[model samples]
Target: MSTQHDAEIDALLGRYFDGLYHSDSSVLRTVFHTDLSYVNGTDGTYETMGLEDYMARIDARTPPASRNDPREEVVERIALKGDRIGIVEARMTMLGRNYQDLLTLINTDEGWRVLTKVFSFVERKD
Candidate 1:
């Protein structure tokens, strides 16, 4: 069904947002693949992180929720390539930035997992 991707992606995004809001790498580990790669190029520079470094950075950050920072996310689209490959487009705001994310997914034996995340961010208006 067309809505199925929406449901599954929504659930995944929920966890993603929670992990980010709390800066909880443990929570993120559940949803993100161990091989996940995060990329960002909004500043005209190629910035990227592998899961280990990403998790460590997450662990080191101040939890946005603790600072009462606003949490906002909208899943703009979700589509599947056959049944195994998928992609999700989303926008979110956190930690003084607004981000547009392209999340590549794969339906593993373990269910849908984020394989790679390419994102661009701009500083949020205060």
Candidate 2:
């Protein structure tokens, strides 16, 4: 892929972080596919989420940003596979917990959108 494509993916990731921090479903919808599958294993049991349900959960929450404790998310890696598929790993911290997310993205006609996510979290004792 060209540098331009890489830049676009980077920009999309930026929006992802923004959406996650603010829990803004609008911003999130821009980057997540309609058929998204989200998985969380923080509790030692897997919890799965679908796109619409996840959006609804976002809407019901009070954004951490509003509390001045917005989650901090960092993109650790982005690996593109050919022109259509990519993998992204990111870290986030909020409420004394650290989160690690591995996202699968596809470059669709609408642009690069996350198709699936697998995540885990650990609570900080200190």
Candidate 3:
């Protein structure tokens, strides 16, 4: 039973990683809630925004096709408490910089969706 639950969490984590790697806003819409909020490391501040704002950022981001080759690291951890809440951390590498994000997820009637994300620059060892 535990293994099955782990597998489910793993799939959720994968979807989150794939979404960012491909810059697919629709995938993001699936993973994140309508009231999602996040802190932008580049700005060093927290901002509360709707799903549309989040999607806009994804759209504004320089697509992987435009970059040399963006690489997304594996999800380090994904944990769920019962069936209502979860968390995941993933590493991302692009443009000679390393970034990390810790995401908080909430299970809604529809399914698991990210409620918030806290992102930061992990390292820049180029």
Candidate 4:
């Protein structure tokens, strides 16, 4: 049986994926902490951004609603520390690339919120 913590984490991850696909900053906001940071590894370099900047980038883009893209997320691992922190590793396919992301989350009074995301993406050769 899944615990409340498990359910909460699941919901949080779901919202994250949905937010990315739909480009809905509001939905993303609910799951991300105010101090959010994302470190992205691409090509042979790394780029990082804060929550506001990332959300703004999303807001400026056209929503992917018309893309009908496949969102296949595989949760590779989940590690819970004490009761307040969790680290989740997941892989998904998007924009013709396969991405692996590590999300750090914190359990707050309101709920679990993602604090940081470190990810790497590689183009699908197939």
Candidate 5:
């Protein structure tokens, strides 16, 4: 792949973080594949779903951006498995929750798309 691959991943991840913070389904749709699997295993809570349901959940929430929440997000690492597959480790905070996300992506004809997301989050009380 080209050296610009890293930049593409970074830009995609930026959109991911921005989408989550703002609860913008349209933005997120560009980040996640339609058949994407969503896994949440945090503090003994195990939940799994698909992109449509995930979007519904996002739509139901009061967006952090609306509350003037601070965004503390970072991409810890990204590893490419050949030319078509990639894995990313990321961290972020929203709605007083701290999250660690492992995202697996597939490079499609349309570009890189998040195919699966396994994440854990801790609720923060302050």
Candidate 6:
């Protein structure tokens, strides 16, 4: 990838990570496609959900009170096959647990938007 492409991917990574940490749903919406879907691993089960359902689930699980001090870390790897498509793998640590998310993004009329996401939890040893 050229330096400019790398920079764009870096910016996208930063926005997505910052949004998750701050629980900024508006930012999340911008990164994710309207029809985005994913399977979230929780308690040894993979629960599939769409964008709206996922947002509601996030709202339900993350209490407004607890978000006063939300913590997050994201390590991402991006691969660009061409100018309009890329894959992003993000390993995230949030609320003392680790999760892995693989996302496919496409440059659309509105800019880069997430096409699909596959995610799973990673058991942390402490």
Per model, state how many residue pairs clash: 0, 0, 0, 0, 0, 0
User: How high a TM-score does candidate 3 get?
Assistant: 0.79
lDDT of candidate 5 over 1-126, digit per residue (tens):
465578778888989999999999899999999889999988789999999999999999899999999889988989997889999999998989899999999998878899999999988876
Per-residue lDDT over 1-126 for candidate 4, one digit per residue giving the tens place of the 0 to 100 score:
456699889989999988988899999999899999889977686999999999999899766665886667889998998789989999988767799999999998889999999999998897
Error of 2 at 57 (Å): 0.9
Candidate 3, residue 33: lDDT: 84
TM-score of 5: 0.94
Instruction: Point out the worst 10-residue segment of candidate 3 by lDDT.
Output: 1-10
Cα lDDT over the full model 3: 0.75
lDDT of 1 by residue, 1-126 (tens): 665566676788899989999999998887798899899878776788999999999999999999999889888988889878889899999989999999999988777889999999999778
Tens digits of per-residue lDDT for model 2, 80-119 = 8888998999998875678899999999999999999899
TM-score of each: 0.92, 0.91, 0.79, 0.91, 0.94, 0.80
Point to the candidate with the largest TM-score.
5
List model 6 lDDT by residue over 1-126, tens digit each. Answer: 365567666777777777777666777788888888776756678678789987776555664325564355565677777778888887877765677889998888887888788887766675
What TM-score quantifies how close candidate 4 is to the native fold? 0.91
Q: Could you tell me the lDDT of residue 97 within candidate 3?
A: 64
Error of 3 at 36 (Å): 0.7
lDDT value for model 6: 0.74
lDDT of 6 at 93: 71
lDDT of 5: 0.91
Q: Give the CA lDDT, 0 to 100, for residue 50 in model 4.
A: 94
Judge candidate 3 at residue 102 and give its lDDT: 90
Q: Cα RMSD for candidate 3?
A: 2.6
Pick out the ten consecutive residues of candidate 1 with the lowest summed lDDT. Answer: 1-10
Model 3 stretches with alpha carbons more than 4 Å out: 1-4, 41-48, 65-68
Error of 4 at 47 (Å): 0.9
